[model samples]
Target chain A: MDVDRLNLPSDGDGPVFKEPWEAEAFALALGLHERGLFTWTEWADALAEEIARAQGAGDPDQGDTYYQHWLAALERLVQAKGVVSETELTERRDAWERAAHSTPHGQPVILKP
Target chain B: MSHDNDDHGHDHRSSDNHWSELTLRVKALESLLVEKKLVEPAALDAFIDTYETKIGPRNGARVIARAWSDPAYKARLLTDASAAIAEFGYTGRQGEDMVVLENSAKVHNLVVCTLCSCYPWPVLGLPPVWYKAAPYRARAVREPRAVLAEFGVTLGGDVEVRVWDSTAELRYLVLPERPAGSEDLSETELGLLVTRDAMIGTGLALPVASLSKRGCP
Candidate 1:
């Protein structure tokens, strides 16, 4: 797929994924976009909104927190597009936290049936 | 949440730590999206892999090295960057439109995306954090010489620094001047001297002496 418009943060080699989750978040946004959930313009707008909101909240605007804004934008767009609801997102987040706690150290967190 | 420092002692995991929270949020989002069939996990992996492995500055390095070695290729690159870059099989995404800025004795070119981080992903991959940060974005256009100095690049007063602001439609790549005393180096070897910062116009290509110092042949 031609993701002609999407721009991502990177270093010399490529996109700088400081953490595994950062890459996952970045990819998830692309995945949703590829599925035609929202246009690249919509994604850009949502990301800009998140960045502005963070700045308004006294975020230093340093590069370190970029992906946090990215993740926020992805979540916002997914909800705004009606692909998922706020309640579902919150419930899923809480479920993941519980799973994370019960999981062994360094083991993948798995939601129980 | 206070079930810590008893059994595991020093090994207690800060499950609520900032990164951990982010990790959980991403996991939750991915899980929800997958379950809803809005996004496939394989597609996500493909996107990540494309950026992480397939695309990067190395592609741009080869382009620059080829330009340095072949006059014909250089002409094509400067005249029609997208078409020339396509010859190397690097075309897609942010690279739909491209302009190769040639650095000469009298001129230097630097690229910045003042509005967001629009970059040529096909060649240069994603841009560095500093490129997207507020400081570089504001200062690159205002005080380019000072910005270049911070990146350890110092040009003479005779040189004019031209800053190119990249947009979603057009992206710029700096074709750094080839270093002297390296005419004998093959194109592949020349590519090894090209750096990501050089293509971004933040630094210069490595000289042959430095390569030898680093035990490179």
Candidate 2:
């Protein structure tokens, strides 16, 4: 699925969804990362661990749905990793929203190109 | 050694101008957060992560694809859109009232969140980065024809592009006319041409191809 044109930067070249799994997996990792529950390293390890566990559990979907794994990985990484508290994360979100949408330059739309 | 590659020659003047004009308030708030140390850089990084990666095109694609296949459903979609979308299990907190407008020989529909970029969230998922900003919200209604031109879509006098303002309470979807020579395609196959932008009324569904060229994006 193409990203909505309205959602893109005014100067973005084009929307690209070259691979289907990319977006779902990205969203899962992002949701966990937003809460600050895992470091980049931990996020990687959690995904690998989830893959192993899914394989062991005889998951038929296999590698197709890393998003599912991503969600599961986040659920565990949050409690086990102890990177950030829920309340702390909420506070951060509130602050980010303040910063991200506060004014005309709050969030950088051209972050990706 | 310090090394940096500034490969892109994007107009910083324009980007900066746009950024300053639209995100000044957001930047101010971010500065305040930095002052207080409430949001860690890591947390902020993750926020962007979900924003771009997790909440993505699949959500919007599903809506556009569905509308292409079902006309009676599309009719209901325009009549009481939010309720009709519920049939496909697209209802949720994010999805508010959504209206699906069908484009035909006589009428064409385009949607913009003119007042503040409020959109049909449930069916489309999270709004895109551009949609929520100031320029698109303001210019889309005032100069829709010009804006469409920016996207390389032109309408003739035979067709009328009616611009609809999407709100939190009422949102709109454009049911693009089904392409020619696609009568034999499956539901999923036909869905491919239903681009996310088309559903949001920025463009038309990609025209279909003959049998040999089926499955082309």
Q: Residue-wise lDDT of candidate 2 within B90-182, one digit each (tens)?
A: 664432466678888788788876544455555565555455444566667787777776666788868777889865456776777788877
Q: Where is model 1 more than 4 Å wrong at Cα?
A: A1-15, B1-19
lDDT of 1 by residue, B1-217 (tens): 5784476445455543223888878888999889889889888898889888878889999999999999999999999999999999888642248999999999999998775676788897766777766667777898888788777789999999999988667888999999999899999889989988899898899898767776754
DockQ of candidate 1 (2 decimals): 0.32
DockQ values for all predictions?
Answer: 0.32, 0.05
Q: Model 1: per-residue lDDT, tens digit, A27-95?
A: 987777777787666776677678778878997666678889999988888877778888988888888
* Tens-digit lDDT track of model 2 for A3-113: 243344453213322233344334434444444544544665665577557656875332234445544665456547554345554454454444434334443532211
The fraction of reference A/B contacts recovered in model 1 reads: 0.46
Which residue runs does candidate 2 get wrong by more than 4 Å?
Answer: A1-113, B1-55, B210-217
Which candidate number has the best TM-score?
1
